[model samples]
Target: MSPQRLRDDLVKQTKIDVLTADQAKDNEAHMHTVSRSFLTDTITVPTPEMMSYAALSSLGDAVYHEAATDALEKHMARLTGKEAALFLPSGTMSNQIAIRTHLTQPPHSIVCDARTHIHKYEAGGAAFHSQAAVIPIHPANGHHITLEEIIHNADLTSDIHFALTKLIVLENTLNGTIFPQDEILRIAKFAKENDLKLHLDGARIWHVAAELAIPLEELVSPFDSVSICFSKGLGAPIGTCLMGPAAFINKARWLRKLFGGGMRQTGFLSASAAYAVSNNFEKLFHVHELTRRIEKGLIELGAEILSPAETCMVFYDPAPLGLEYAEILERAAKLPDPITLGGSRLVCHIQTSDQAVADFLALISQLKEEKKAEGWVPPEKTHVNGNGVIRDVYVRPKAIH
Candidate 1:
């Protein structure tokens, strides 16, 4: 084909508009929906003010160290009291990269809390990316893991019979329960004496600081490396920063490229994250308060609080009221102003409205009344599935029609 004809064809195929004619109205509706959602904080959308500010960011390529990206990294490094920081697309990448960078040799293992995102939700990235074995340990107290548990489970031998434990990972606000800082210090001391590296999956570490009024530097000081996300409770559109010593982050920056996480023109994304830290950090306190309200409401309606709102999430069991999560999910969606839920986890975010909390409690109260009218009784024993695992009752929404 002639050059002119090829150019014309490419233009014709690429020139298409994604926006609807009523884009403004649609966006307004979406904002309203997000305000009422208790599904997860990751669903929270960026505000127009944040987007407007992002538009003016430097248009530099991130692989070559973009200006805004560099600034954000520096700010995060200072904020977390680390020597340096590197930005990645998601918290998972930040975490996996940290793991890959820390474990240079094979036949190694990482000791972590049983309910950590690294082990449960990262799709086996530690094993896949670094070829490292994971030792997941449950805490006896049922909240945060203790130093004794780490000492008991960690493989510290060099008998060539077991994978040597080189790293210890912990999560802040795992299931919305803050990992006690005092315990973290104790573990940190153990890690130091044993020459083991300590890392933190601090995606919601902002919540710990917000709830307890602790400084970020002090909160993360115990860990050798820490990954903090801006998208979850802080409501940034995208990006997470992995902070550590200058050498560790420098190596992680290279691995970030090898993992195909390097981006071009990341100035806008960095600016959005910076805005989240500046504008949305204080808002997390309100999110935690809202979460506590949901916990209190569920308790008043006779639901069992499996996990209280230590931060921005609460896990409750409605079995005490003879209600299943599936029924509650269906009923809440059918309300005049619908509220969204995800199984037992109710995560309140910066955009969550007071009215949403009130509506959620109202729905639970109504469901309790309906169950009473139908002569439903709470089971003497907890509901168990065929596999003998107690059911939490997560259900996908059926067709509306």
Candidate 2:
């Protein structure tokens, strides 16, 4: 089937409702979103409330100024205990700038976990922009990468045949599991001993810090460079900061301009980030509590959780429930307090409320009871590829976008 047709079939089978104009307006107030990284869909574009807050700000910056952008950079620098920081347009830009800045010479490589954002989600931008190859270390448990594993993959020899490894990139809260503190310290020592620059893909570092009750600065003090997204879990609309040494940030600033990340009058966005750093950072602990509530409820309803809830993300396998993916989503959408399920991964953010989570748990409980009464048979695994090919492939929840 064509891709569009497959989407149509999935929507139809799932009974996904497209809201009309009036319904959409009502949804603005009552809809419960369980699978988003940001505060809400309304926050994607600035709402009137956001605008009002942004309007209560000072004048904007031209290229670089000391008011908003400078304050934000300084705030992040202090939070991460780095010498300097630069605000970039997106996490991708921040991460790539760090990669390119670290690997100054060609034929350099970066060692990271196999499922890292740079390895899996950055669209090969590391190689495209930095001309660096990535050596991904796949963990046996498929959660956290140990220092031993990282050392096993490290190739620091100055051989002409192999690409020189210049950096070791680590991701905290990779798929909601915090990289252990001792492991992180061990890796940092290893990187220093091996003459490898350590970079942290700390897109969700806020979540990790909150989970461990560790201050952000202490958490990221080991790495040479760190990329953090204010937009994700921090409730900022759009902004990411690359924090590192003064010289490293100076190089990254030039690269940011080259990559079209330099922006004018960005105080409007930075002001929001500043607000989030002060306001929303503490709320992540509560969000994780809500996530655990959902996870515990789901397990009671016979859902097989794929991983333990660590921060704001939960992964589960729904295949054992004897239901197709589309059907599972259909039941979820048809609930009285309807939910918009995103495959098998459910994420909680600042806006995910206790009542919303309770409603979702109720919906799952209802489905489980219905399934027991119906004696439904397990269906063959039906999967759709990116190109719309139908195959008997099992679907797993994807990492946070």
Candidate 3:
């Protein structure tokens, strides 16, 4: 289907005036000024088609327990191509449960990228919930940690006073980097030889599948356990699934309840996930294309686009224009129409499009070209290179530290 046709269908299905208010409010809390019409997500709601699935989204209290577990088990089993899957309200819960289940012994350590979501974004949930110490390895560039690094670190593993290596957690499409199947196979072999349980944080696995032209199951097959998120790029309202051994998920269900992640009649939410799995998968490809277009545009404009446009994220450190982070974010939030970004986090989802891409490019051009006086160099702007003499030029400005 054409993107325009799908958007029209979504319009009939979604209620633009009402469905998007909540999102705007949510965005407002974070300093965003947006109208409902600008959103691309169908779940942004008031859409009639999305409402048709109310039967699926509305689960009774007892059903929340049964359906949540059922959804988790069903999807996860398919994900790892494994025995079971468990549902949790948040990825943090699923990850914590995975860690706790793997670390049956005390003082066990989890090896993961230093920028792993579990380490960088999930607060100290691993420490507070699992009580396990993290062994972090930074990716040489972006979030793509090398398989050789995993092996070197794991082979040098020890049972000394320090925590014993218990689990190897990898975020596929690390921070913003995506790994190929060959890399997964290599790391999985190393993980197996050393007897460490491997976990794949497939938060953006769906995005990777679209980008790499690989099946989700094939992409995640090497890991012993896999955690998948429906909310990120999949555009589900909320939910994450943890797939592993049936026995492991059996324990996970209880852990989810303990963490207050259990919901009643969760098939309502899972139904959206089901819709995403069935109908929404293709849109991710559009997101990938749009991201490439935007990143390329940025580069063409002389901004240093970060590498690994592997999935949905496009990270750039715009120098010279290195203004205050707060000011940069503030500008992003207030952009009039067909634009947004307020959080300093630039990401693309299924709803993002070429129009949005063009809008963002135009705004960036404006931001980059604005100068205090004539020419490109603004007196306030400054950058220092290897040479002692710092030169000023017109370029994308990244926030200074």
Candidate 4:
């Protein structure tokens, strides 16, 4: 084939217009949906102002330590009072990289809460990347793991049969409940004495600071490394910063490349995260307030508050109203202006509208009345174990006709 013909074919394949005529309209509708979504904070979209600011960022290869990316890393390090930070594409990557960086050999394990993202949601990245076993301890207090639990469960022994606990991981605002700072300090002290590295999956740690009125540095100071996310609750499009000692981050940067996460021209992405750090952190107060409003409304309408609005999330059971999650979900999706829900976990974000919260409460009120009229009886109230049932309900889209 002729060079010109080959070139023409390639150009034709690449020259496709991704945008449809109604793309703007669709995006507006999407924004409206996100404003009402009670699913997860990760669904929050980037704002025009944020994108515009990001567009003006320096266009440099991040593999070479791009100026914007480097600035973001340094800023995160300063905020968390760490020596350095590494910007990665997701919280999972940051976490797995941290684990891989912390552990050096086989016959090792990392201890963490049973419900932590690292243990349950990271697709076993620790075992895959670090060849480490995860010791998931169910917190006896039903709130946060205590130092006693760690001491009891952690395999600190050099027994040939078991992997020695080399690292301890903690998640602040696990299921929207903040880990007690006092407990964390005790655990940190224990970890230090035992020569175990402590890491934090601080994906929603911003919520902890905003709700508790704590400084970021003080909140993260106990851990050797903390992975703070920009995407969840902070409203950035994508990115998580892994903060730790300078030497540790340098090694993490190399592992990031080995993990195929090293990206080029990441200035725009870093700038967006910087914007979130600067502007959106304060907005979490409003998010928390909105979450509290939902909890309050649910309690008033006779819904069981499974988890209180300690931060930007609340888990509730509709059984008290003689209703099921499916009933509310069906009614919510049918709203004139539809509100999205993911079952028990109602996560409020920077984009979550006050009206959305109101509308959700109104839906519950309406459904409660309907059930009462239909002679539906509330079931016998039993203590629902916080860790027993999976909280979040997954919804699939119906055919649009």
What local distance difference test score does each model get?
0.92, 0.79, 0.68, 0.90
Stretches of candidate 3 exceeding 4 Å from the true structure: 1-47, 56-72, 141-143, 155-159, 320-328, 342-344, 378-401
Encode model 4's per-residue lDDT on 220-337: one tens digit a residue. 9999999999999899999999999999999999999999999999999999999998999999989889999999999999887777899988888887677778878888999999
Q: Name the candidate, 1 or 2, with the larger TM-score value.
A: 1
lDDT, residue 378, candidate 3: 30
The residue-by-residue lDDT of candidate 2 on 85-165, one tens digit each, is: 999888888899999998887888889999888999899998999899899999976788888888777777888988888
Better of 3 and 4 by lDDT: 4
Model 3 lDDT tens row, 241-319: 8888888877877787788776776666677677666667788887777767867887887666555466666666555
TM-score of 2: 0.84
TM-scores for all predictions: 0.94, 0.84, 0.79, 0.94
Lowest lDDT 10-mer window, candidate 4? 392-401
Off by over 4 Å in 1: 1-7, 380-401
Using lDDT, give the best candidate's number.
1
For candidate 3, what is the TM-score? 0.79
Whole-model alpha-carbon lDDT for candidate 1: 0.92
- Which 10 residues in a row give candidate 2 its minimum summed lDDT? 35-44
Candidate 1 residue-wise lDDT, 1-401, digit = tens: 99999999999999989999999899999999999998889988989999999999999999996999999999999999999999999999999999999998989999999789999889999999999999999887889899999999999998798999999999997988998888999999999999999999999999999889999999999999999999988999999999999999989999999999989999999999999999999998888889899998898888988878999988888878888888999999999999998888888999999999999999999999999999997665556987698854533332111
Model 4's TM-score against the true structure = 0.94
